[model samples]
Target: MTTCRLCGSSNLASVVDLGATPPCERFLTSEQLDEEEPSFPLHLRVCTSCWLAQIPPLITPEETFTEYAYFSSYSRSWVDHAKSFVDAAVDRLALGRDSFVVEVASNDGYLLKHVVQQGIRCLGIEPSRNVGEAARAEGVPTSTTFLSESSGSEVRDGHGPADLVVANNVYAHIPDIVGFTKGLRALVADDGWVSIEVQHLLTLINNVQYDTIYHEHFQYYTVESARNALDSGGLSLVDVELLDTHGGSIRLWARPREVTGEQSARMVDVLEKEKAAGLHELSGYADFSANVTRVRLDLLRFLVAMEEAGKSVVGYGAPGKGNTLLNHCGIRTDLLPYTVDRNPYKHGRFTPGTRIPVLPPERIAADRPDYVLVLPWNLKAEIMTQLSYVAEWGGKLVFPIPRLEIVEVNS
Candidate 1:
């Protein structure tokens, strides 16, 4: 029986099932691709007790993220987002040289660099050795270890409690979430703040972002669930921001429950919004499976029609989200041919389950495929701007989520 990760309730219900898929970010080499690949069932189970949407136990953290391929610095928009967050955090906290900052899952030092530039002491806690090495090379002091109570206490004891603890897009990657949160309390100062950014469950359902459901992502959070997780871990949410990054996300600020500060009005407002959207009710999630099936059929039809018309289709971005979409839809190289990404780590690697060869962005111009499927649909605007040349050849850019639609490129 699959019990809820948040509340330990066996009253878990499966809302969206993508069948079985390999680790979404496990891009394969030529040799690995030739060998048989392993896959696990991908299903989002909602906890009736707490409303946290989570994937049933499939793979461990070491299997999903230890030798991670995804890096934060590669995306210009993501770096900018991090910089903006750093700016806001510095200003909001009135942080200066005396303040210490730490970021968990700090891939490639993208955000901490901005913090360090402000003359504040910054440290990164990242599990991936390769990514930690890159962060350290860039002058960001990073520790390559999984965040737990012991590691968090070690960090606190070694460098003192952090004035600001940041965890962005990482809360979902953890398997033992309670331990992860308890570790946050250990790392944070009494008066310091804890900020987390998670892809909101409300946004995921309303946007039909089923592609975000993968092995690497364990739990999706609504405001209530987010609050529950924080409270359980000995923290309290004080403020919140609904952001548009990663399709849609929620940036939450938390502090130790003992802190006497009143909750921010915006946080209350967001909670009310979630309540109005029926996030606490099972009825809110009942239709997601149907929507997932609809998109799958719609995407299949689009791919089939394009292929029938002798159209050559290529993909942009070898993101884990793309892998989920591809593998779940049973799309293979025969349909996609090859995909392009700017990240060199994934350039020569094949996508996990489908085995689609990833090439450089230059391949789009060389091959001039009839259609370019924008796999990372959330970054469509940025990608479309970069691949504007595709329009010159009468090729249309395709966005696969929320419905597959051809986008207009500037002349």
Candidate 2:
């Protein structure tokens, strides 16, 4: 029986089943193109007792994220978001040259660039070799390995404890979440803070973002669920902020018990709202499966209809979220011939499982397909603005989540 990763509860219900899919970021090279991509069941379940949304245990960290193809610097909007985060963190913590900042899963030194500019001693822990190497090339001191109890102990011995420990959009990627949190306690100073930014589960469920359900994201965390995970490792959440990034996210500030601070009023308000909204109830998750099925059917119908009309359809953003949607909906090259991505590493490769070739964004401008399906719906606005030329050809952009709808360029 599969048990809850946090509370060890075996009581769970299958909320949405995404079938089998390959890891979204694992684009295949030309040499590896002949090999069949590995796929595993993409099932999401909610613990009836703990309200924790999680995927089944299948892939390990070593199998999923070592030679990662994604880089944070590729997205202009994501870079802007990271810069804003660094600015706020510096201001809130009153950090200076004496302060030390440690970032977990710090891909490509995007955020650390801002921290280092302030002359603060900053170190990054990135597990992916490709991304870590890129960060090193940019003068960001990065360690390429997973952060667990042993690694955290070594870090404490060498650099003492950190003044600020930041993790951006990475808390959900861990499998042994309990061990990860315990490691955070080891690396944090008594009066220091550990800030974590995660995609909020409530927002995802409300927005019908079934595409985010992938194996890479092992857990979907709510504030209540997060508090339990933190308390399990002797950490306490002191503040929380609702962020606009990642569609909707939460930035949580935590500290050891020795440091006392009032819980943010906004945090309390959101927690109470969640409690009232039945987040702690099992029935709240029951309807998600139906929504997932509806999304798949609608997207497939739209694609088949476009094909019948002789309108070529292409995809934008070869992100993990997009991969989940594609593979779950059984989308192959028959429906989407190719996808455009700005990430150089992913260029000239095929998306895992579906095998859709990924080319540079210039393909969108050159081919000007009749329909451009914005896969990463979270960045629909950013992508729409970038590919506005599609409108000149009487083409419309299709957003395939929540619902499949094509909107005019100015609409």
Candidate 3:
């Protein structure tokens, strides 16, 4: 993009060009395999002025989220994480049965179900019709629409202002950062808390998690940039918490500017940490592109050596991040014959660009593949426990990001 999506600055610098890949979630049906798949440039650029890392908004949110393939409830750890967050939020915010909660991009009611059980009134604003229906079926009051300023205002008007607004792993998904933030501000009460959990740019760069970069995530954020983004919507950053989810993420606690209190010590400490990492300057990103190349090379070498050794390597999850890693490393079915996912929607489909077949999780044990490459490595603990049965067949698990490592699972 010529200008930064958040700051409107014309100055932008390259972080890494992952070459071109299809929309990560655009899985293909057998009937459409003969048709040409569409691809777009997957380049990440940082706006020096605002220090916000972003990709060109080649695909709209509607195209990706309208009939989304990702169902959040598939991951047991994530569900447990959501439940923990709900419990903590209720306690921290002194929420009760009379309190109202709103969650943006609430997928399949994974989180709001906990809110429901607490006897609190809650609404989920999810864009995907399929997942939205699933949420409704589970008794979550959901409105299927993208969060814009208008929609957020309408929700607030219809249901009254939320006592707590929770947006998890979705702050970076929208191209219009300012408008989305405004929508978040619109949905929350003037004195209510807004809690957002997003992948921290500090962790993304330091850990070389380039695989998370896709057309769907238009921007990345450090606490500095996130604070600025929140300010644009009249929300002031109050507290911050470093989380282990999605490799590394930051949970930002914010409030309306008028009611915002002094910055929490935790927020101040995180900002200092970002400064120590040089995230506020261009130097922190200097080694990122080279590090990304190293990771791609390392993973490719492992896969190729496995192939030459006559060892079968299949993927564990067909997540969006996995598609980026596969497409970037130029891996086809020859290297990874197929991958399995718990999501039924992807069982018969092929991963975008890579075109590797997706099967059910049972196939891993049934086929007894020599190695199961764990694609969604962020949930390593949970996945390893579930696939510990692989040890029965002398199968090992492979993790690609943060570094390439193969582990022997104990039964």
Query: Which candidate number would show the highest lDDT if scored against the true structure?
Result: 3
Would you give me the overall lDDT of model 1?
0.90
* TM-score, model 1 to reference: 0.98
Residue 153 of model 3 has an lDDT of: 98
Q: Which candidate is the best by TM-score?
A: 3
lDDT of 2 by residue, 170-252 (tens): 89999898899988888888899999999988888877898888888999988888888888777898788887677788898
Candidate 1 residue pairs in clash (backbone atoms < 3 Å): none
lDDT of 2: 0.86
TM-score of 3: 0.99
- The segments of candidate 2 whose C-alpha lies over 4 angstroms from its true place after superposition are none
Looking at candidate 2, what is the lDDT of residue 343?
A: 88
Better of 1 and 3 by lDDT: 3
Candidate 1, residue 262: lDDT: 86
Mark the regions of model 3 whose C-alpha exceeds 4 Å error after superposition: none
Q: Give the per-residue lDDT digits (tens) of candidate 3, residues 1-411.
A: 799888899999988999999999999999989999999999998889988999999999999999999999999999999999999999999999889999999989999999999999999999999999999999999999999899999999999999999999999999888999999999999889999999999999999999999989999999999999999998999999999999999999999999989998999999999999988888888899999999999999999998999999999999999999999999999899999999999989999998899999999878999999999999999999999999998999999888999999999
Alpha-carbon TM-score of each model against the true structure: 0.98, 0.97, 0.99
Q: Which residue pairs come into collision in candidate 3?
A: none
